[model samples]
Structure formats: structure tokens, C-alpha cells
Target: MSLLNNVFYFQNGIGVLANVFLLLFYIFIILCHRPKPMDLISCQLTFSHTVMLLTGGVVWVTDIFESLHVDNDIKCKTSFYINRVMRGLSICITCLLSMFQAVTISPSTSFLANFKLKLKKNIIYAFFYICSLNLSLYSYLIFYVGGLTNVSETNQMKVTKSCSLLPTNYIIRALNLTVTTSIDIFLVGVMLVTSAYIVLILFRHQRQHKHLHSLSHPRSSPEKKATQTILLLVTFFVVMYWVDFIISSTAVLLWMYNPVIQSVQKFVLNVYPTVTPLVQISSDNRIIKILKNIRSKYHQIL
Candidate 1:
């Protein structure tokens, strides 16, 4: 195995392990506590991240095996499509979470206040519809993505293999790209705008209460801290999403001129899935309390 492959293998393995930890931790929290809207959304996000990591990890492992002349086109294509779907679902869930936070913190007299009240009542239904929509939209992958085919045989006994889109029609390709790009752009734009609004609200509140004691100001509110965390999460997701988008777009435009581009794109795609759980846990009070309890018990035992 090449050094680069080894590095990716290690990275993916770590991601898988981290996601597993997050999944278990989230499940435990949900089971032990009264589930709030944010907690439920977080659980869904963690589940999506776990699936993304597992599917992507499988593809990476398959790549390593392929380097050793082991070919499994079916497994690779299946994992690839599943990973793509999970990635999209993760993005949508993150966007939803940001929107929820935005609504939660909306001013009582603001226009969104009534919508926020309605949204709280139907949050579960909203989540169900979001998951169903993403699943249905990404179902196109099953039709277009296929197993690897032998492209060429080199004189050195090396065989080149690739799993490519089945549709050769330019219209199909264009339609696919257009739909995917539109969805990504719309959701990302919502996340950015909503997060910006939340930040502006907090900033204005802080400024307005600058003379007040910390306890009296909304600046010290838990809602403000949660909003800040969600904003940070959204910011990180946007950065990673655009980086992956740029790399993938460049690779497509260049048409496989640089193999390194593909590797970088894969790495970039995994970044959010790997890091999101850590970020969520860091901002989660329940997780913090659980950890503190464990620490206390450990100290007493010691």
C-alpha cells in the first residue's frame, strides 16, 4: 500500500471510531433524558454522520484493497451512492438545525415569532419530511451509478478500473448537476442567512445591554451560547462544503488530469462528517454533565 493510502486508511478508521462514539453517546443521552427538539435534531445529525463515515470508510477500504488487485465494483458503487445520500442528508439536517435555532431565538414581536411557534408544534413532522425528501431526491443515484468497469490494460500488467455514471446523455448529466447544485446552494444559503441573522440579533442584544450586568443581559443566556455554537457549526460546514465543491468542480472540469485532486476531494468531503460530532458534543450540556459525572466517579475510585 502507498503511504497516501495508508494515511487515508488511518484517517477514515479514526473517523469511523469517533462517529461510533458519538452515536452511542447520543443514544444514551436520548434514552436517559427528556428529549427536546434540539436533542432530537442532534440525534438525527449524529446518525447521519455515522452513516456517512461508515459508507465513506467502506469506500476507502475498498480503494486500498483495489490497490492490491482486489476489485469489488458492486460494493464500491453501493457505498459511494449511500455515502452521497448520507452526506446530503447531513447537510440538510444541519441547515434545519440552524433554522430551528434561528426561530428559537427570534424576538417575540418579530415576524418569525408566529412561524416559530408553529414550527415547534410540527418539528417532528418537519424532520420526517426533510428526511423523506432527501431520500427521494438522491434516489437517482441508484439508476445512474454503476459498478466498476475495466477501462484499459497497461503493458506493465496494470489494469485501470473505474466506476462512472451510466448515462452518457449530456442532458442527463446537466440535469443531474443542476439539481444537485441547486439543492446544495439553496440549503447552504439558508444556513448562512439564518446563522447571520442569529448572529446579528445576538450582537444587537449585546450592544443594547452593554451597560447591564452579565446576568441581566441576554449575552449570558444559554440560548445565546447555543446560537453561537450552531453558528460556528454552520460556518465550519460552509467552509468545508465550499472547499469540497471547489475541488470536485475543478476535478470535473479538468477531467482527471490530477489524481491528487480526487484524493483531496474525498478528504474534504469527510471533514465535516468527522468533525461535526466533536463540535456538537463540545456544545452539548448533557454530554458535558455526563463526562463530569464520570470524572467525579473516577476520582473517587482512585
Candidate 2:
């Protein structure tokens, strides 16, 4: 019932709800409606976000697991492992989504256009690969510390906001950090590159549309709308991610733990997933049309 606890619960609750809503919506689309190209990927991203929120606060939410009489060490390890894995997936999947949208909007003359066929064919495989890789990479955390933390190590990471989650040799710590940061940088770099490509294509497309139709507000195609949404998502994610990454890297390297800084970092971590669904709900024409139809039907029944 502390202020930080309240904030954490609120943020995680909002994030979990938003992600679950989108998860169900995406599933409904895939099952009952004509699925959009982004549906499966978005669904996977939402599921990752939901699990991230639930597991990210394991230290604080341990009461839920305590019912099963799980040890505190086990709780911390579970949280650390899942949180890291989901964080990895979030970046990888966001990069993939941005790259796919770029390809979707690319002109036939563009080089990205050639990959469209192959990308669509292999998209599911890409998801599976990302999941398998993250699961394998972050699984080390659960065992890397040898079950319990070494409080004696000054370089122990204050993960799960309070748990000294990772304690190992400097060499191992450095190696893990290097590997994780390298993968994150590679994924984020992909997002940035594809986002820039998308923005340029959108600008050129808008100009062409205006020139052809001589209209002030040219209507956008569905592909253009989807591209814009993905761009916005990538931008929001990069901004949030860099904030969290800078703080986390600084803490992990320096072995510094400030309560307030960790709190802020936790908030930054949840912001992207919480806001993404709202953005998609508002921007997605299908969601809007569905809401409008439901409203009309309710009004008629009333």
C-alpha cells in the first residue's frame, strides 16, 4: 500500500488489460473475421506484453505465487527469467512488425518489395524463431546465479525492482551484458532503419496522391494506415526502450540501486505496452467499425 506499490499495480494492471484486450481482439479477427497481415504478429506481441506485465512485478506480486508455497528465490528467478525473455521478444517482434509494414507499403520498384512474398510465407517461422531464441538466451539467468544471489558481490543486479537477481563472475556478467545489449541494439537498429524507410515512402506516397487527385486531404489506403500505425508504435517503443535501457545499463554496470530510480524504470517499462492497444484501437478502422456496429445494435435493442 506504498505509493510505489500503488503505481506499479496501476501501471501493470492497465498494461495487462490493454494487452489482453488486443490479444482477444486479434484472436477473434483470426478466427471469425478476415485476418489482416499484422493480426498474428500483433497477437503474439500482445501476449508477450501481457506476460511481461504479470511477471515483471513478481517481487511485489509474490503473494499470488506464495499461495503455492513457492520459495522467494524461485519467485525471483522466475520473474527475472520471464521478464528478460519477454523484453527480448518485445524488441524483436517490434522490429519485425516495423520491417514487415515497410515491406507492405513499399512500391513494386523498391527492393523491399521483392521480399514480400517470402516474408509472408516465413512470418510464422520468424515468430517461432524469435520465441525460441529469447527463451534459450534468457534461460541462463535462472541458473547463472546458481539458484540464489550472492549478496557479497558488489555487482549484483537489483532485478525485479528489489531482488538481487544476478550475481556471478565479472567475466560472465560482462559477457551476458554484451550479448544482450548487442542483440537489443541490432533489433532496435532494424526498427529505426525500417521506420525511416516507411516514413520516406509515406511522404512520397502522400505527395503522389495529392498530385494525382489534387486534394488537400487525400484518403489513405489501408496499407498506408497500417504503415503509419507501425511507425508510431516503433517510435514510441524506441523512446521508452532507450530510457529503460540507459537506466538499466547504468544500474547493472555500476551496481547502484536507488529506490526512486528503479521505480521510474519500472514505469517506463510498462508505458509502451499500456499505450499500444489504445493507439491501435483508435487507429484501426476495423475496430472502429466494429464498435460503431455494436453501439448501433445496442441502441436498437434498448
Candidate 3:
């Protein structure tokens, strides 16, 4: 058990470090470059990943303390709620990225072209709305979740490190699950559909324009490249989302019999945030160019 806990801690530490680097890099990009629609969305996504990873790390560390019999109710609940909000925000941002890319790449004659133009103009407003919606939706956790407690035979008060949802009737539980699941399904569905559409559009365009480029030059256009990147991001998000969902949905049944399910669930939840930053950096040519230039400059100075 100690060895397993150490492994979890090490994984969480690496995720936190990766997210921190992403945060710094995105901030620098925003400050140094003219912020386009894609840039704004990328910045938002990076920020979301940073917060999600940080809160996840806090929760994992708290769990370790919890295993040691340290009691910190408020810290546990706070981190839990914050992590939930950040997780929702991460999903929303990924959906936004996929939707934006789909709209941007639609053909001029397509019906979505007009909406794409308008969306590009008001993407910042859309992003703000998404952030607000996620915060508001997940805010319920603050009121409904708290640390478990136990009373000693000697009449002493004891708080457990684990959090417990407040007692609620079946209706409330069903309603909460419905709402959360609905939103998740809707956003994920949108991401998958739009990403597929973007790929189709890119494929058709490439076939039509194949004669324009030389045989030796097989590189795709910048837009097509970016669309491919967004598709990859959506794919990763979908896999992680479903894996976590399955584990969580069946957790009650499996948790008591198989303790490893909880660990796997936690790992699946954190994997996307840890890897997203690296994916974003690799997909963006500008970011890659800047990083390479920095590396060369450092080497020359050395």
C-alpha cells in the first residue's frame, strides 16, 4: 500500500509540474503575440488544465495525509469542490476548441460559414460564458459535500479525511446525476461530431486541391494541420472522459471488492490534463518555433 501510494504521489507531482509549465507558456504566448480566436481559446484551455492539475495534486496529497489519520475536513471539501469545477471547465474548454475549429474550417458556401464568422468575432464572450456556466453548475458541490465525521465513545469529536455528500433523497440524487451526465454527454457529443465534420471537410478539400501541390511536398495546410490537432485532442478527451465515467458510475458496486478501481479512476481523470499541454505545444507551429529558437539561443550562449 505504501509503495502504491508513493507511485500515485509521483504521478501527481509530474502532472502538476507539466501543467505549471503549460500555464507559464500560454501566459507568455498571450502576452507576446497578438491574441487571435484560437490563441484566446488555447490560453483558456491551458489555464483550465493548470487549475485542474493543481487541485488534483492537492486532493491526492490530502488523501495521503488522510491515510495517515490526519483530519482536515475543510481542506478536503474545498479541494474536492474546486477540483470538480476545474474538471468541468476543462471539458467545456475542449468542447469550445473543437467547435471553433469546426466552424473555422467550414466551406464558405456552407451554412455554418456565417456562424463561424460571427463566432470568431465573439469568441471571447463565448469563452467567458462557458467559464461562468461551469462555475455556477459545480458550485452546488460547495454546499452539498463535506468531510465525514464520527463520534468517539468518550464523546470526543472526530473528522474523517474523506468527504461525504450530504444526505439527500432519491429524487435529488437522480436529478443531480441527470444534470451532470446530460451536460457531459452533450459537450462530448458536440466535440466528437464537430471534430468528425472538420476531418471530412479537410479530406474533401485536400482531394480537390491535390493537383496544386508538388508530389514531394505532402504537408497539409496550416488550417488542416490545426484541425487534425483538435481532432486528436478531442479523441484523448473522449477516451479519458468515458473511462472515468464508467469507473465512477460503477464505483459503488466495485469499490468495496476492488480497491484498485478508485486508483484507476483517479489516474484516468488526471491523465488528460497532464498530457493536454504537451499536445497543444506540439500541435501549434508557432509555439514549437518559439521553443526551438529558445533552445538554440541557450545552446549558443553556453
- Flag the better candidate by lDDT, 1 or 3: 1
lDDT by residue for model 1 (51-93), tens: 8877665555666666877546565556667778788888999
Q: Model 1: runs farther than 4 Å from truth?
A: 59-73, 153-162, 213-215
State the lDDT at 226 in candidate 2.
Answer: 77
For model 2, how does the per-residue alpha-carbon lDDT over 247-298 read when each residue is reduced to its tens digit?
Answer: 9888877767677788888889989888888888888888899899999999
Which candidate gets the maximum lDDT versus the true structure? Answer: 2
Tell me the lDDT of candidate 3: 0.74
Estimate TM-scores for all models: 0.86, 0.90, 0.84
The positional error of residue 99 in candidate 2, measured at the CA in angstroms, is: 0.6
- Candidate 3: worst 10 consecutive residues by lDDT? 151-160
By TM-score, rank the candidates, best first.
Answer: 2, 1, 3
Model 1: lDDT equals 0.75
What is the TM-score of candidate 1? 0.86
Most TM-score-accurate candidate: 2
lDDT of each: 0.75, 0.81, 0.74
Pairs that clash in candidate 1: none
